[model samples]
Target: MYTANNIADFFLGRYAAEGKITPMKLIKLVYIAHGWYLGLTGKALIDENPEAWKYGPVIPSVYHSYKHFKNSPIRCEHDSEVTTGSEIIDKFLDRIWKVYGKYTGTQLSAKTHMPGTPWDITWNDLKDRNRSSLQILETDIKEHYQQLASKNANG
Candidate 1:
């Protein structure tokens, strides 16, 4: 039940060379890692098939990661088919990093740059060979953080 935010908060305090980029990239990496974990553990909520295990190495995991970002709290109201795919990853991470800063009261972005590291990936790199699969990854990350919040509240 290790959540993205949990790992991210810890990483940001430690491994993050630059506070802002560390959490931003870690958030993205968490979703990627979760997708891979789901694939390996046969726990993917995105697809319904045993063969999903095969897609884990690349396709399914990436798609799930993108979906989590798309559904994040910072999601734009304008949902255009255009600029809604991998193009939004940069923006997605930006908004989340800002929120993280607000919550922590830390000047996380003071020394960081925007559009930090291009996830630099395309839909072709994910499943169904479609850009829409990006949504899956975005959704997964959002849920991961939500889980973190819930766990902390209870604990």
Candidate 2:
């Protein structure tokens, strides 16, 4: 399994040339990549569990790392020197890029907020209602992504 930063950097590296990767988009992309990796291979792509924030599910480290950039496109000083060091992981990220790379950060954020998404489930299920920091369980994420894969495969 890789750290969330590793995955974040990988996405950053891939999009450095494209100039549309934002903190929000990078967080969603990394989260989606983790879910697909876990759902498909039954292995986590990143070690961190994403928290349900008002905006959506967020990995804290990745969020903090790029928050300084705010709504603008991220141009990190060290941008994109990431390598997951697993051939399968690399191939999988490439696939994710091909599938999701077209959308902007706002578009990706809306996708995460969609009904029945893991972020939506975890965010709404909260009784204590922190609304900004509750962690979305890995099991919930895995099952959700697995269901998506199944639904897509069937249709």
- For each candidate, what is the lDDT? 0.35, 0.85
Per-residue lDDT of candidate 2, residues 1-155 (tens digit): 87898888888876667768888888989999999988887887888989998989899999998899998888854445456787778889989888888988889889889998888888887775544548888888899999989999999
Model 1 has an lDDT value of 0.35
**Model 1 lowest lDDT segment of ten:** 111-120
| Candidate 1: stretches off by over 4 Å | 17-23, 44-134, 137-155
**Best model number under TM-score:** 2
lDDT per residue (tens digit) for residues 18-82 in model 1: 33332234434444444434533434423321111222212333334334554233222222222
Residue 37 of model 1, lDDT score: 40
Per-candidate TM vs. native?
0.27, 0.90
